[model samples]
Target chain A: MSELAQALDTLARRRLGGDAATGLARMTAGATQEIWRFMLVKDGAETPLILRRAPGGDRVSESATGLEIEASLMEAAEAAGVPVPHVKWVLTPDDGIGHGFVMAFVEGETLGGRIARGEAFAEARKVLTRQCGEALAAIHRIDPAAFPTLKRVTPLEFVTQYRDGYLASNWPRPVFDLAFRWLLDRCPPPPENPRLVHGDFRNGNIMVGPDGLRAVLDWELAHVADPMEDMGWICANSWRFGVEDKPVGGFGLREELWAGYEAAGGEKVDPERALFWEVFGSLRWGVMCCGMANSFRTADPSVERAVIARRTSETEIDLLRLLAA
Target chain B: MQDQPTPSEILGAVARFLKEVVVAETKGATSFNVRVAANALEMMRRQLDTAPAAEAAELASLKALLGIENEDEGGDLATLNAELARRLGAGELDLKTPGVADHLWATTLAKLSVDQPTYWGYRAALAERAAPTET
Candidate 1:
């Protein structure tokens, strides 16, 4: 057995009361996280569980909110009616597996393109927009006291941050320059009651079923910010795949998402501020695409990383669509 | 001059091979990556065909926007683009300026033509440009 499998077996033995962790396989889902699928066996009973561990082996950046913290956030989110994988065990120092947690494996489609276009999700498509809104409202409604450690990043702070990122990238793209200028000039004030914003709410990050949304995935980017930012981030064209007309994750409109949010007890939707963040989201994705491209040269020079540089222009065109007269 | 069976022609062959042959042989992650590789090659082939003219057009626009007389002296497209970005960042030029918005729009459209012509945003921009509508 590999060291990871042994540790997982140990972890299963200690916490899950399972004799062994069998059928261990690495799942290639999230690019930056280590996802392992395994079945824990205890007394002839089997339970499928997923292990989400830190990436890059012992290089947890300062921005990482710690796996324990993420596990706890999932617990709190479950309480707030947000669908998430139930975090079962957090690795102790004795496990020697670095930072990670085990959760009950979620079953659903996570592919953005498939969810947007596949006939399998045809039923899910009808209710997904409202469900997403409701889910976001629930996530935002979670008491801040549950996660005091999460950083509070307002629009202005992140806009300036992306601008700095673009500058550091030394990109000569004029659209990015114009986007930074436009966002900085019109940065909205932080919400009166700053809520827990799912910093990376989009199609791929969400798991859906034939019925509707199953669970919202990827809580690593969770932070405190305006609730509408969630709505706007989903509406960003980058998340739309090729279905441009259905802006809300290429499944529904912004108004429908806002309706679901409001119906679920979120604040009245501000179309203008949401539109601003939509623009903000586009530029942010653009800068992040460039970041991936930058890493292609030194850190990881895979063909995948090299070609992602071309996708930066996809975000550029998205920005133009939003900001153009 | 570059010889016949040019760089683009070679890329086209490789892309066809990957899409038709290599892709069928691979499975799982390797298959997905082979597809990505083939698409990248196709994108490169498209860029080779379209990018030079687009770059020339963008250079001409940048010179006009910056009010420069000599292309040889004013620096190449990359440097001129850097200046444009800097000026925009510093508030020296803005959308109100005659050529700023148009230049930005045209340059981005040109880039999409080479980078991702099938991208939804690119198609939308093309459609909107073809017919003005309240979208």
Candidate 2:
């Protein structure tokens, strides 16, 4: 058995008292996490489960809530009536699988392209923007008082982090330079009552069924900030998957999303601030793309990372488009 | 002068083969990586065609905007861009500065014409630029 397979077997036996872990296979590798799917056989019953862990036993995160917090946030999200896969177990050192949690595998199409354009989801598309808005409102409404570890990131701090990373790259991106200054010039004052922002709320991070909005995934990026950040992020051009006309994840209008957010009692949706964050979102993704390429050169050498360098130009154009309008 | 199958054509062929053959042969992570690999080749192929002209135009525009003549030795694209970025960061140049926004837009659009021509933002920008402007 492979080392990970053995670990899974041992973990299943120790944690769930399963007889064995069968059909173990790795899922599509997320940038930071190793996802392994297996069926835990216990008392002749097979339970499909997923192990989401930091790569190489190193706690992999950048401005991320730790795995333990991620699990807790999911539980809190479920309590707030957001769709989520039930977390089955949180890994302990005794389990020997490093830092991560086991959760029930969510069954749905997570592909942004498919959900945006697939005929199967045509009906779901009609209401998905509103659904996403509602989901974001739920996430924002989750009181930060519950989690003491969570950091409250101001809009300026968030932009500065990306700016620092970009400047460190030592690559002179004129468009990026302009975009950063523009964002800073118009940075909105921090919200009177900051709320939890689903930091990576966008198309690829969400899962959808034909019925719609099955699970809101990848909560590690969650932090306390202006809730409008979530609103702007979903409307960012990168996540639209080519359907840019529909500002809400390529399937719904901005007004629809705002309406849904208001219907769910979210803080009043501000169009100007939302636009500010949308521009910020493009710069953020551009910085991240450049960072990936930097990682390929300086640390991790992967084909995926190297090619991503070209995508920085994509964001450059996106920033120009956003700013031009 | 070299061969009938030019370097650009060669890259395109290889990318197509990977997308058609390797993707069919592999599943999951390997398949995804192969697709990205194919995309990289296709993008490079496109860059080969578009970069020379676009970069020349960009360099000319950068020199004009920065008032840089070929007196000193530091005129490479990267070095010039770095200077421009530094000036922008130091508040020397901004969008309101004459030709700054236009230069940035043209150069960025030139890059997108190679990297992601089909990207909606790129297309939208083209459409906007082509549209009749207010007097």
Candidate 3:
């Protein structure tokens, strides 16, 4: 049996008070973590659950948000009225399941390409943008005090962290240096109140359902900082998926999104500050793409990642142009 | 006059041969050699395909943007590559300046040439997302 199946069986007996129905299937998309879908039977009914685990012999980064922390953040966000997947249970490191967590399997479409193509989701696209804005506002409004385990970084410090992290990686590229300088010069004053910020919020990161937004997924990069960082990241041109005309993830207008934010009682967003973060978002992605490519030398020699690294030059260029503008 | 093949041209021919013959034959041959050969082949192919064009374009653009009209002493590919590397390493590119847009456009084009479909798809997605929201 697969390791995941064994873990599921063990967890079912220990926690769910039943037996695992089957291994079901595994979904492999994330380069960093392994995600599996399984079914558990407790009498005659079946409950669907997701299992996330670290890859073979790999350990989670020290700086990364742990599975327990992510679960806590999700719980807090849900309590604050944010639409998110209900946390089932967090598997402790001693569970022999590696570092992972179990959560309710929320079904929805997550393909950014399909949404951007304007076919099945054409009618729902306009509403999805507004939904994203509202969802983000709800997440930002979460009380940091509610989640004591979660670490908070000042907005300026977060910017510095990204800047220092990329440079310290020792990948020599002049464009990144330029982007760093621009980010430093344009650092917005720290937020008056720090709030939960979804570090990787974008079109691809969100799952959209027929009704509207289903659940916000991938909180592995979550943190507490300036909420506008999330707004700027979602609207960055790199996340727009080639539909230059549709700035809000190929979905709706910025004003529409902002309107939704205002309705959710979000503070007035500064356009200039948003632009700065947008540029920084692109720069951060550029660095990540480069790192992904470099990583192919060791773990996961994916052609796709190598391709991604090559494309970072383009993103870097975009950031440079934005900085210049 | 018979034009001799440049170093990049020679490498390109070898890469093409490897992709067409060796890579295709490897499917039936051996698994161990498959991944190693494929990765090495890809790197070689990328270098062969991109290096010359990238170097020439970068030099021409930099010269034009910097307005250095004098004939470049670094005419050969090696010298040009070294100079480009030096300039980039020394942080002379000035990415925050408006003039960097030309460099960015050029670099973007270079990257677009080699990036896989997923990268293009992501770019398309980002552009689509940004369009309706553009003010």
Which candidate has the top score in DockQ? Answer: 1
Chain A TM-scores of all predicted models? 0.96, 0.95, 0.90
Off by over 4 Å in 1: none
Residues B1-135 of candidate 3: C-alpha lDDT, one tens digit per residue: 757686556656665666667767766435434444554455555666786779777777666555567766545544443444345434565544455555755555465555532455435534544574546
Clashing pairs in 2: none
lDDT of 1 by residue, A185-288 (tens): 88898678989888898999999999999998888888888887888889888888788779999899888999999999999987888988899889888898
Tens-place lDDT digits, model 3, residues A174-268: 56666666677678787789887878888887877766678888888887788888888887777777676777887777787888887898888
In model 3 chain A, which range of ten residues has the least summed lDDT?
A: A316-325
**Evaluated with TM-score, which candidate comes out highest?**
1
lDDT of each: 0.87, 0.87, 0.70
Clashes of each: 0, 0, 33
Q: Which ten residues in a row have the lowest lDDT in candidate 2 chain A?
A: A55-64
lDDT of 1 by residue, B1-135 (tens): 979999999999999999999989999889999999998998889889988988899889989999998867789888999999889877789888998889988888878887788888888888988898775
